[model samples]
Target: MWADKSYTEVTFKGCRPTEPASNFDKSVDIQLYTAGFGDKVGPLKHFTKCFELSTSTATWTGLPKGLYYFKIVKIGGESHELKKIDVDQVRVDTTLAD
Candidate 1:
């Protein structure tokens, strides 16, 4: 999903297969970085911060306005490209109030 100014938070959802009759336990690691920086090196190396979610759904908040690269890491250390978004810039109404 794209991060835009209208939303204050970002949510990611995914599913994983678990061993039958065993406890369903797993986590996902989310990383964010400046646009283009993420691809030059490892996601973890250039990440701004890391977020872990035990369930399939994850929500990140308090993100600043800018272009960011997103990635998701599975429990086994596999990384998946998520998306790049330029947080929608807020347009201010400069005209004098009518």
Candidate 2:
């Protein structure tokens, strides 16, 4: 590998059940850790409705009320080491009724 690199992302969602929200439908957050970046730090990317960005976070809203969970993925190349983050689903309660 040429050099070690890492990334992180997070999404914030707000809903009122008035409209369906697809942006935060597949939103995710992850905590990254690797030995490759001994001293150097990487950037954290936030996504809102599949929009790739380099900001601290992505704010979303206008979604139905329901339970939701966070999804995380560890990215790596062929030459670089790969690690998958282990996380569990969570319950997100909303006022919307199905």
Candidate 3:
């Protein structure tokens, strides 16, 4: 999860497979969805972005201020959702002075 005044960049860390033999070659897929509008309200949902992680750390940037749903997909032997994240109201600080 991440929040910033100017922009939002969510950083995710990669974890080692529990069974190295079975999950060694697996890859991470990130999917972002807009939950709703105004403090995470409403039911109008939409897909926002998708990313494939190829490094130890992955970052998702340029996100608008709203509620977001994330799904981490592990693709290898069998594709499955590894985790889910819900980000509510990503705030921006427009009052910061340079």
Question: Per-prediction TM-score, please?
Answer: 0.36, 0.24, 0.42
Better of 1 and 3 by TM-score: 3
User: The CA-based lDDT of model 2 is what?
Assistant: 0.28
Query: Which model scores highest in TM-score?
Result: 3
lDDT of each: 0.34, 0.28, 0.38
lDDT of 1 by residue, 23-90 (tens): 32233455545464443212332222122322122233444444555455433334333322121221
- Kindly report which residue stretches of model 2 are placed more than 4 angstroms away from their true locations once superposed: 1-55, 74-81, 84-98
Number of residue pairs clashing in candidate 2, backbone atoms closer than 3 angstroms, sequence gap of 3 or more or interchain: 0
**Candidate 2 residues 34-62, lDDT tens each?**
33343222333333323232222422234
From the highest lDDT down, the ranking of the candidates is 3, 1, 2
The per-prediction tally of clashing pairs is 0, 0, 1
Considering only N, C-alpha and C atoms within 3 Å, which residue pairs clash in candidate 1? none
